[model samples]
Structures are given as C-alpha cells and as structure tokens.
Target: MEGRSQWGTRAGFVLAAIGSAVGLGNIWRFPAVAYENGGGAFFIPYLFALLTAGIPILIMEFTMGHKYRGSAPLTYRRMTKKAEGIGWWAVAVAFVIATYYSVIIAWAISYSYFSINLSWGEDTEGFLFGDYLHLADVPGQMGSLVPGVFFPLIIVWIIVLGVLIRGVKRGIEIANRIMIPTLVIVFLIVVIRAVTLPGALTGLDAFFKPDFTQILSPHVWVAAYGQIFFSLSIAFAIMITYSSYLPKKSDITNNAFITGFSNSGFELLAGIGVFAILGFMATSQGVGIDEVVAGGVGLAFVVFPAIINEFPAFNEFFGLLFFLSLVLAGLTSLISIVETFVAGVAEKFNISRTKSVLFGGGLAAILSIIFATQGGLYFLDAADYFINQFGVAALGLVEVILIAWILRKLGLFKNHANEISDIKLGSWWTISLAVITPIVLGWMMIDLLRLNIMRGFDTETGNYEGYSNMFIMWGGWAVAIGALVIGIVFSLIKWRSNTSAKEETEDISNVNN
Candidate 1:
C-alpha cells in the first residue's frame, strides 16, 4: 500500500483550511445573523464562541488528525473500534452537504453568466422561482430537471472530483492556493464598490449600530455560537480530514487560531459588503434597511440581483464579481466537503483514490441532480436545515462527549498537541470541550427540537418552511437520522485492507494507547 500524503508546505494547509471555513454562509448568513442578534454588540458572544467552541474544537481535531495521520474514520478507528461509527456519521453529514451544496454552486455559476447582461431583470424573485429554478408548488414534487441548473451542476462535480483525483498536495492544496487568493481579490473589489454606493453609510450604520440591550438575551448568544459553529465547518469531517495531511512538525494550535481568525475576518468583510449594498438597495427603493434585509437563497439570488440592477454604474461588472465570488467560495468549499467522503471511502475499503473519487463523487453528483428539479429548492431547504441541526450539531455533541468523557482522551490529545505546538494546551481548552461546548450545544439542540415540535403543531405550516409534516419527516428528519444509520452500517463492514484489529489500536503512539 502507498504511504499517506502530506501537505507540500504549511501555507498550503492553512490556505486549504481557510478555504473550507469560508463559504457561501460567510457571504449571506453571517451579516443577517449579526444584524438580527445584536448588531455590533453581537461580537461579544461571537468572539466568545470562537475562542471557546470554534478554535478549541479545531485544535483538538487538528491534533487528532495530525497525530493519528489518517482520515476521520480511520483516525477514530485507531482511537477505538467502538467509535468508528461516529467518524462515519461525520462523513455522512459531509456527503449530504456535498449534494445540495454543489447545486448551489451551480446556481452561482448560472448567475455569474446572468450578471453579464443583467439577465434576471426587474422581477428578481419571480425570475428565480418561476424562470430559473422552476420551483414546484409544493415540496417533494421532483419535476423535470432544469437544464440551467443540471448542466452547471455537472461542471461543478467534474471540477471538484477532478481535483480530488489529483491527490491532496497537488490537487486540494494547489486549488486552494489559487481559489483563496482570487476569491479575496474579487471580494475586495465587490466590498470597495459596495461601500462607495450612495446609501452605503446608512447600511454601515445599521450594521454597526450597537444594540447593547440584546446582549443579555440567550437567543443572541445561541445565534453567535451557531454562526461560529456552522461558519467554521467543524464536525463536518472536513478539518479532521484536511489536517490529517499535515507534516510531523506542524503547529496544530497556531494553525487552528489562524484558520479560525481568517474565517471570522472574512465573515466581517462579508457583513460589510452585504450590508453596504443592501443599504444602497433600500435607498434606491426609498425604504428602511429592515425592509430589504434577507439571507440565504433570497439574499444571493433575489436581493442581490435587485441591488445589482440599481447600481449607479458598472452593474454588469459588479454583479459578475459578486456572483463570481460566490462561485469561487462555493467551489473551494465544495471541494473540501466532497473530499471528506472521498478520503473516508478510499481508506475504509482500501480502494485507490481514483476509484474512490469515481464511486463516491459520482454517487453524490447523481444524487445532487434531484436538486436540479422543480422541487429541488424545497428539498434543498429542508435537507440543509435538518442536516445542519440534526446531523452536524448532533454529531458534534456526540463527538465531544465520546472523546472527552467516554474515551477520556482529552488529556491525551492535549498532551500530544502541546508537545509540538508553540502555544501549549491549557485548562481552558479542556474545560471548553468537556464543559462549555457541550452545554451550549445541548441548549441549541433542545431549542431546535422545541421549535420544530411547535412547527409540527402549527396548523397553517406543518413543518420547516411550511412544507408538509410528512415531507419534513422523510426529506428532512430521515436524511438527518439516516446518516447515522448508514454510518453504523459502514462501520460494521469488515475492512478489505490489510489493517487488522490489533494493528488499528497498536499503530497509535503510547500516549494514545
């Protein structure tokens, strides 16, 4: 068998890590979350979450991967055979995310072209639902595929899988090296243009105006932690897989800080750019900022198009740059998401990388095609909501509990990371994982469960997004829970590789054993 691949340089690994962290959510999600939570005052909880939950978890996962020198599943299997299923659960979440996530990038690709001529026109919302997506009247419709989305989706998979087949250092690293810098440059141009718009100051004021009263709210704190959690892409089987490629002497603690800070910095920039333009839109429409505020698909596909149409000058060029940024950001993230399962499949079955890319990437690509249909958006929305809440959040809670309490391995991981890191581990790191994160995440889960239950009872709206309860049960809840069932089944299968049960346990250092 071939030896594990290592990153060519520390810079390459950092770029890739940052690339995974910064994605579509940074552009659309963070700005709205910040505004809705506490405006400028949200930073208090946001910064706290980053330090306590985000960076601490990143350091732990980085240490685990670097020390074990294997993919997420393999790394957990090395820790203990009983925990291999948890690793596969993370991989399954990544797999589901990759499916709908690629379709979104395809939307950006189409929109980039649409930007060239201001093609979406005045009725941006109508154009998106009626013309572009051809959204079905109800959920689970699965009408014929939209060529606009399907074709570009094919291109997205081809590019992502092509990169994976090239191996880690040559493919993932090199792609991030180009995409991350280019994404920054393009986004900077967009931000500069956005801030110069006529009502830019109004938007900036609305964004930065501190609402200190909201700081005491539990919902505000939860929003901060949720944004940090989803934004940094932890517990998605990504950082673990990416960090597994690090060389022996790499600084896990510093790398976590760098990745965490870089991602938050971009989110700050995104807040500025998004709000600045939204301010311009409000001014043009002679309305308040609150009237135009939005996030997710509506912000990207609907509000942004309306804003681009109102641009005083260079509408086409500015629109193109904005959507192109989405494309670049989405591609970089999609590459990382796809690679998680790709690496998992390759190592689990002991198949060649090429075979793994074909088998895994091909399946995800095929599954993603459903999102290209009329009911695609409904399916996408439900799956994304349920998966993030149930899959990623639940998996994260389980991961921390298993490693911290069940396996009692935080001390081992802390010692391993400290030996090679410039910044040594402290009680804060241990306390955050064992205590702080679990408590907050538990609150988040319970809150989400309560909300969903209330929604289920609502007569007018049966479930999330007003979809039928049956649809949410199958499309949303099933997909979220199905990942765990699939993970356990995968774990139960015997390895086809030369790895023996004893070898899995013995391969780790004495510290781990």
Candidate 2:
C-alpha cells in the first residue's frame, strides 16, 4: 500500500474536526432546539451533556482512530480483530449518512448562490419553481422534486468529488483552510449585524435570559444531550475517521476537549446571532418570537430569507455571506463523510488511494443523484435524523461497550494508559456507556416514537406532511436501528474471523522460528 497521508499539522486536524462539528447542527439546528426546549435554561443541560457525554465519546472516537490508524471499518477490524463485523456496522452507518449529507450540502450551495444574487428579495417567486417547489419551503416540499433542487445538488456533489480527487493534503486541507476561516469571518459579521439590529435585544434576551424552571423538565435535558452529541459529531464514525490520520503523539484528550468546546462555543454564538436578528425582525414586523425561532428548514429557508429581505440595502450582501458560510460549514463536514468511505474502501480492498477515492466519490454521487430526484430535501432531512441522531447514538453505545468491556479483556486500555491524560475515565465512563447513556438515548427514541404517532396523520393537509415531526423522529430511528443491527452482527462475525486468522498466523510464525 502507498503511504497514507496524515494531517500535515495538529492544528489542521483540529480545524477539520471543528469544521465537522460546527456545521448546520451548530448554526442551524442548535438554536432551534435551544429555543424550543427552554431558551436560556437549555444551556445548563447542553453544557452538562457536553462535559459528560460529548467529550468522553469524542475522546473515545479520536483514540480509536489514532490507535487503529485506519478508517472505521479497518479500524474496528484491526482493534477488535474478532469484531470486524462491528467495523462494517460503522461503515454502513457512515455510508447512509454520507449519501444524504451531500444533498444537504447541495442545498446549502443552492441557497448560498441565490443569497448572493439577492434573489430572495428581488424575485422570491422565481426561487420557487413548480407551484409546490419553493426554495424557501424545504421541509414542506418533502416528497416533491424540483429541477432547481436536482441541478444544484449535482453541482455540489461534483465539487466535493473534485476536492476528494485531489487527495487529503491537497484537497481536504485546502478546502478546510478556505472554508473554515471564511465561515468564521462571515459568522462574526452576521452576529454583529444581528446584535446591532434595532430591538434585536429581545431575541438576545430570549436566548441568554435563563428560565431556570425549564431545567427541571426531562425534555430539556434530552434536548441538551442531543444537541451536544449532534453538534460535536460525536457517536458517529466521522470523528474516528478524521482522527485516523493524526500523528501518534497527539494528545487525544486535549484535542477532544478543544473540538467539543470550540463546537459548543460556536453554537452558543450562533444562537446569539440568529436570535438577535430574529428579535429585531419580530419587533419590526410585529411577529412572535416563536415564528422567528421556527426550526429546521423553516429557520434557514423561509424565516431567514424573509428577515434578510427586510434589510433592503444590504440584503443580498449579508444573505450571500450567511448562506456562503452555511455552504462552507457543510463542505468542511462533507469532506470527512467522503473520507470515511474512501478510507474504508482503500483499507477493505487494499486498493490504491486514487482508486478508492474514485470508487467512493462515484458511488456517493450516484446515490445522491437518486436521492436528488426523489424529493431530495425530504430525503435529506429524514436521512439526517436517521443517521445523525439514532445511528450515531447506537454507534456510541457500541463504542462504549467495546472499549469498556471488550477492549478491557484484551488489555488495550493498559497500553493506552500512558497515552491517556492524568484525568482517568474510571468506572464513570463505563457506567455511562453501558448503562446511563444508552438508557437516555433509548428514552429519546421512545419520545420520538410518541412524537411520530401523534403527528403522522396531519389533519390540516389531509395527507402525510413530508415534514411532520413524527416522520423525522420515527423514520430517523428506524433507519438508525437497522444500521445498528447490521453493524453489530457484522462486527461479531468479522471479529471471530480476524481472531482466528491472527492466532493461526502467530502460531505458524512461531512454528517456523
């Protein structure tokens, strides 16, 4: 095999990790969840989850990646030898995620292009194609495909492919360098614009002013934990894949903290930026704060565009910056998704990097195209919930189980003790992974099931609304559970095979010697 390219520097790796962590989840989803759960009170649970759940899981992923020195599939196979089946599970989960994630990136690019053109204000109608095809109503048009959506989605995939074709150092690094900085600068500008908006303080107050009473609610706690997990890209194979390229001596614990904190801090800042601007808009337009804080596609497409239009002079410019930032954030994370598969292919087949990338990139593009035609936006949302939410949570459960129990049997942690920080994980990590975290995640799944049953039949439309909360919740978990089962079964089979092979190989070598 050719020499695998590692991250050129530690900072590069961190930037890439941060890029993955701080995407739509942070800027788009976090604020919405925070507002819906309990505004200022949501921060408490979010912070706690970050420290307890997010950081530990992140450290575990990073450590696994670095230790195995391979992609998710190969890494798990290598580490657990007998547990190669689990590696496949990670691969399957990652693949499902990458397929749909690209579509979202495509949407972000489409939005950014129009935002720069100021199309939202000049001809909002043109942004909508067929009667049901409105660029602004992504969640609403779940089951419908607009040519406008398909065309741009293809463009996004092609762009991602082009970057991957260039390889990690030249492609991934360059993209991160440009996208990460641009995202930060644009985010700052948006935040400043939002805070300065007349009467924007109302939104800021809503975000910052704590309603401590809400903290007592289990719903709030769940939201915080979900946000922390989702925001940091923990429980997914992305972090592990990204960390695979790290140098041996890098501090996994400190780096995990950096990634977690950087992500959460950005999320908090994003909440401030979004709510502040929304507050000003609400004050000016006599709209309720709830309207301004409406989530998912509503916040990104309809509400944000509407708010941008209010600033006639700078609408196009700021809109451009905002959407461009979204595109960059999405791209940064998208690369990692692509990399996970590419690395897997390379390791699995012992193929050349070039071949691996082409295979993975081609496959992803084809899958995305199919998705594009089939109500891409709707598929993207459903796939995201499935992969990012339940898929990741399940993976987290497996990882903790493997490390805390399975790896312990092999004494992997004993060797890793010196590499780990002085802050020992102890039984707490095991308890959380084996018991606490899984239970919490299970509860969220149940809650989601309930939410779905309630909303599945939309009385208003007399049809199943593509964007029904139930659909997102239930459909997401169904996909997640399916992926989890595949992963666990595959891991067990592969683990047995790998262990047998290793033992045979060792015995033969010993006999010959």
Candidate 3:
C-alpha cells in the first residue's frame, strides 16, 4: 500500500470521529429507544452502558488501528493472519450499510426541497411512500426507479465521491471541520425554537419523565448496551479505519470519551428537538404524545411533515432546518462508511487512493441505485433490519471474543492504549470487553435470532410483518450474512507480500512526521 494518509491535526481527527459517531440514528432512533425503555430512567442504564461497552470498544478499536497502523484488513492481518477475515468482514458490512444508507440521504435531500412549502401536506406518509417513492406492493418487485429518488441519489454519490477522492486529510477532515460545527449550531437553533413552542413541554415531559419501573426489566439494560453498541460506530470498519489515520501520539482514551460523549450529547439535542415538534403535533391533533410519537422513518418522514404543516408560521424555514440536519448527519456518516471500505480496499490491493475510491465507492453507489426504484423502500427496510441485527451485532460479539479469548490480545491492547493515552486503561476495560460486552452482545444476538431469525420479526400479525418471507430471508438475511462470506473470500486473496507490517508496529519512532 502507498504511504498511509494521516489526519492533518488532532482537532481534525476528533471532529471526524464525532462526525462518524453522530448519524441519523442519534436524531431519530436514540430518542425513541430512550422513550420506550424508561423515559428518564433510561439515562441510568444508558450511562452505564456508555461507560462499559461503548467506550471500551471504542478504545480497543483505536488501539487496534493506531498500534497496528493500517486499515481494518491490514490491521487485522498484522494482528493475526487467521483473523484478518474479521477485518474484511467489517469492511463488507460497511459497504452494505453505505449502499442502502445513501438512499435515505437522497430522500432527505429531496424532502429538504419539499419542506419549502410543506408540500407533503397532512398525508405525509402517503406523500413519502406513494407519491415520492412509488413503492411497490410486493417486496421483491422492482418497478421503475423513482425519478425523484434516482436523481438525488446520484447527487449524493457525486458529493461523497468528490470528497473521498481527495484523500483523508484534505477530503474527510476538512469536510467534518466545517460540517460538524454547522450541524451542532443548526441543531441547537432547532432545539431552542422547539422548546419555546406551545405544547412542546408535553413532548419533553414524555421524553424525560422516568418510567422507573421499566428499569427493573433485564431487557432494558440489554437495550441500553445495544443502543451504545450501534451508536458509537464500532464493529464497523469506520472507527478502526479513521484511527489508522491518527498520529502515533494520539490519545486513544481521551478520543474515545470525546467521541462517545459527543454522540450522546447530540442525541440529547435531537431528543429535545424531536419531542418539541411531536408535542406540537399532538397538541394540534388533540391527541396524547403516545398517539403522535414515532421513530425512524415514521418520525422523519411521517410525523415531521405533519408537524411542519401545523406550524403557526415559518413552517417552511423550520422544515428546511429539520431536513438539513438530516442531510448533514447522513452525509457525514455516509463519508465515514465509504471510507471504511475505501481504506480497506486500497490497503488490501495496494492501489492508489483515487483508484480505490473509484472502484470500492463506485460499486457501492451503483448498488445503491436499486433502492431508488419503486420497490426500493421495501427492500431498504428489509436490508436495514437484517444487516444491523445479524451483521453488525454478530461481528461485534465475535470481535470481543477473538481479541479477549481466542487470541488473548486484550491485555496487550490495554497496555498499548495506556502507553499513549492520558487516561490509563485498567481492569475495568478488561472486564467490560471480556465479560460484560460479550455477554450482553451474545444475549442481544440470541434474542434477535429468536424474535427475528427463528420467529420472523413480528409481534401482532407474526412472520416478517406484511412482507414476503422469501424477500426477508433472502434479500435481508442473505445480504447481511453474505458480507461475511465476501469478506472471507477477499481475505484469502493476498495483494502483495510485505514485511513492513512488523516494522510499522515496532517503529513508532517515525510517527507524526
């Protein structure tokens, strides 16, 4: 591989890490998970999970990339030859995520324009699914791609590719320096406006009021850990890849805390912004908070549009602000996701950065086009569920096991982390990764398997909800599991023999140049 690219400065790296961690989930998903789990009491388990599973994993990944001094594939190859496939697996998972993820950003970009006039109107769901997406009735059916979505998706790809082609410091770091600050500033404005609105208090009340009783349940704790796992951008190749670009003098522990906390802080801001609007919606409709509140797609597309239409004035302005936040959040995350694959492919194949971005990123963009079709929404939904549940969760579980148990490198990682980091690692890090994380992850996976894999992910009407079993099993599950197979296949093919990995590991003397 060419001499590895590095972040221009510590601030650049920190901003990029925050950008990677803060995504659409922080806005739409975390608040709902908090609301459903324990309202206010969710913070208890949430904080605990953050301390235990989230930060520990973040530190581990940072040490892996910083010490190993390579992209995910190269880093893992340096760690243990047999475990290199795990790195490629992470790269493949990132590729799959980026492919479908961009489609949602495309939707957000379109909605930003529609928000100019509250164009979605009262039947917000219909505008999104029927009028905009032209969603197919059947899951597997691929009707003509939606023109609105296709064009915007192409735009999304263009921006991502343009930035990625510029290499790490010039492209990603510069983008995050501008975008992350802008995201925080704009989101704060939205939150301030939201809280001041009438009935917004009700939404905040619902969001923050502790349903302390729920905390008694074991699942609540598990949910807390699961939320942290997904939110922190670990187990995917993004963090590992990003860390590989850091100077050898970088502070792993401090960076982990900052990145992890920054993500949670953004989620808090999102909660305030989201509930304030949902409160306004409920008040307008003369309904309770529960009736109007929703998460993910419903929250972003359905509820937000309905809320925008009810805005007393400046609805267009508010709508633009809201959707713009999504665009920023989504784009930053998209950049990181693509970088994971780009870095791995470049290192794995000893290709130039430009060529790697073109091949790896170009292919992902092409795959993303399918989600622009009429049946795209159904397909996106299936893929998102299966990939996240099976792919990411499983990989995380295996990662901890591989390091802590299989290879017995957990102590070595901790020592390396403590050597450079301001906050030293201790037995807690070990206990978290070796004991707490694996157990919680293992339980979460088994539970998901029972609910989703074995029983087919339905509660009320059982069996993949209203979708086809073939599409769910094949399209969704197969895509996720297949990432692992593809990753292993890639690992088996060596790019070129080099003895430089050990030199990179031992010779930090040449770092920060």
Best by TM-score: 1
Alpha-carbon shift of residue 109 in model 1 (angstroms): 0.2
> What tens-digit string does per-residue lDDT give for candidate 2 at 221-263?
9888878767787665688788888887787877888888988
Relative to the unseen true structure, what is the Cα RMSD of model 2? Answer: 5.1
Point out the worst 10-residue segment of candidate 3 by lDDT: 504-513
Candidate 3 Cα misplacement greater than 4 A, ranges: 453-462, 497-513
Model 3 over residues 239-305: C-alpha lDDT tens digits? 9999999998889999999999999999889998999888888887899998987899889998888
Clashing pairs in 1: none
The CA lDDT of each predicted structure is 0.92, 0.71, 0.88
Query: Cα deviation of 440 in candidate 3 (Å)?
Result: 0.4
Candidate 1 runs further than 4 Å off: 459-461, 499-513
Task: Give each model a TM-score.
Answer: 0.98, 0.85, 0.96
Clashes of 3: 0
Question: Candidate 1 residues 1-513, lDDT tens each?
Answer: 456788999999999999999999999999999999889999999999999999999999998889777778888888877778888999999999999999999999999999999999999999999999999987888999999999999999989999999999999999999999999999999999999999999999999999999999999999999999999989978999999899889899999999999999999999999999999988988999999999999999999999999898999999999999999999999999998998888888888888999999999999999899999999999899989999999988998988887777899899899999999999999999999999999999999988877976775766787877689888998999999999999999988776434354633234343
- Per lDDT, the best of the predicted structures is 1
